[model samples]
Target chain A: MKIMHCPLNGPRNISEFAYGGQVEVMPDPHQCSDKDWASYVFYEKNAIGVVKEWWQHSPSSYWFIAERHNASDDILRTYDPSELFSERVDFTTGENEP
Target chain B: MTTGLVSPKRCADSHGDRHNDGLKLHDLSLATRSGVRGVKASEWLIAQSLHQELKTHELQPPELQPNTLVELPGSRLLMALSTREFWLLEPETEAQASPIPSGHCAPGVWPLYNQNSHAWLVLSGEPRAEMMAKLCGVDLRIEAFPVGTVAQTQMALASVVIAHHLWRDEAVFSLFVDQSLADFAWEALQDAMEEFNSVQ
Candidate 1:
C-alpha cells in the first residue's frame, strides 16, 4: 500500500488520507468580479510538475500542505499549514471596512 | 461518578461482559474523559495541573510531549495528541453528574466533547499488538509503540486513537472511536481477537 507522511501523525497508509484540492488564495469579494471569485473557488491549474496542495489526515482531521508531483504521484515534502499561514487572515469587504 | 449522557454502546447488554483467557476486551464507554485544544492548550493544561497540586498538596503532573501520555494522581491520565491538543482520561471512573458544557475552557483553549463523541474500548492480552496488526498498518508492538505512546490512526477502516499505557499494573491498549461506529469497531476487534482466543 502507498504511504503518505502526515505532518501531525507521521507516515500512514494512503487510504487514511483524503486529497484536498490545490491551495489557492481567496480574492476579496468586494473587489473581485463574481466570475473571478467563482474561478478561485472551483478552478485548479492541474499542472504537471511539483505542486503544493492541501491534504487531510482523516483520523485526526488535520489538514496540511504537501508538495507532490502529479505525474509521478510522489509526495516531495509535507508540512504543517502553519509554515505558510503564520497568522490569521481576515477578509474585509468595502461595506465592512472601517 | 455518572453522567446523564449515555454511551451509544450502552444498549449492548453484554458490553464489557465478554472475556478470554489471554485476550480480553472491555468496553469503557462510560469512563470519564474530556479534551481541550487550541494554541495555548499546553500552557493551560500545565496551569490547571499546578492549580490542582496547590489545592490537594499532590505532586504536579509532568510535562507531556506530543504523542505521549503521563499518569496523574487519582488514576487519571493526561494524553497529548499534539502540542495543541490534550485528552484527560479516567478509565476507571465513570463520568460525573455535572454537565460539561461545550465552549472555551479558557482563552485560546476550547473544550472537546470526547465523552459524548467517542466510545472507549480497552484491550489487554499477551498478543495484543499482534492482534491489532491485523487492522492497523502502523507498527504497534511494545518495542515500537511502548507504554505512554498515543497513536491517532486508522483501524479496521475506522478512525481510532490508540493509547498504550499501564492500566491496573498491566499494559493495555485504550482505543477511542467515533461513537456512531462503536458497534462496528467492537465487532471488527472481536473478529481479529478470535484467533488468539485459543492460544492460551
Candidate 2:
C-alpha cells in the first residue's frame, strides 16, 4: 500500500490524504499589476522536478506540505507547514517581476 | 449548558436488531460531547488548572500524543485531538456544566466551539477491529491501537473521531461523526459488521 508519512500521524495510507495542490507564495496584490495578479490566479507550472505542494490529512483536517517529483509522482517527504515557517513569507522567485 | 441541547434518536434501540453479544454496535446518542480549540487553548486549561501537565513554554508546543485521553481518577474524559484541540465527553448522569468560563473568549485568543450536534456511536466486541478493517484504512489491531489511543480519521467514507477503550476483555471503540451524515455512517458501519457476524 502507498504510504505518506504524516508528520503528526506517521506513515498512513495515502487514501487518508487529499492533494491540496501546490503551495505558492502569493505576491502582494497592491505591488503587482493586473496581468501578474491574473497570471498568478490562472497559471500553474507543469514543471517536472521536485515540487513542494499542500496536502491535507482528512481525518485530522491537518494541512501540511509534501515534496514530490512531478514525473514520478513519488513523494520525497511530508512535513508540517509549521516546520517550514510559523507565518507566511515570500518564496524567492527567480524573476524580478513580482 | 451545551449538553442539554437535543435528545438523540438512538439507532440501535430503534433498529432492534439481534446480534451476538461477542460483537455489537451501539448508538451513543446520549453522550454529552464538546470541542475545545484555539491558539491559547492549552494556556486557558493551565490558567483554569484543568490540565496543567500540558503547559509548555516552547515556541512550538508539542501536540498531545494521538490515541490518548485525559482523565483524573474520577473526572470526565478529554480526548486530545491535537496540541490545542480537545473533545470533552461528559457523563449522561450529570447535568452539562461548562468546564471553562461562561464567556470563555478573548480577542484573537482561545475560543470555544460547542460540539453538541455531532452523533456519538460505540462499537464494542471481540470482532470490533475485524469489522472496522472493512471501513477504515488505519490499523486497529490491539497492539497497534492500544486503549486510550484516539484517532481522527476516515471511517465508512465519513469523517470520524475514534477512541479505543477496553471494557474488560471486550474492545470498545467510540466514534464521533457529523450529525448530517450520521445515518449514512451508521448504515455503512452496520454493513461492515454484518459479514463478521455471519462468519462468527
**Which residue segments of model 2 deviate by more than 4 Å?**
A88-98, B1-20, B52-63, B73-75, B91-104, B108-114, B166-171, B198-200
Of the candidates shown, which would achieve the greatest lDDT relative to the real structure?
1
For model 2, what TM-score is found for chain B? Answer: 0.74
**lDDT of each model, Cα atoms only?**
0.82, 0.69
> Residues A1-98, candidate 1, lDDT per residue (tens digit)?
99999988899999999988898887877789989989988899987999999999999889999999999999999999998888866675467679
RMSD of each: 4.3, 6.1
| Interface RMSD score of each model | 0.9, 1.7
lDDT of 2 by residue, B62-155 (tens): 3456447754323356677777676666634343455554554553244434344577777777667877888888888888888879877789
Each candidate's DockQ:
0.72, 0.54
Q: Give me the displacement of residue A67 in model 1, in angstroms.
A: 0.4
TM-score of chain A of each: 0.87, 0.77
Best by DockQ: 1
Q: On residues B138-196, what C-alpha lDDT tens digit does candidate 1 reach at each position? A: 89998899998999999999999999998878899999999999899989888887776
lDDT of 2 by residue, A19-95 (tens): 87787877787688889887777777878899999899887888899999999989998888887768645557536
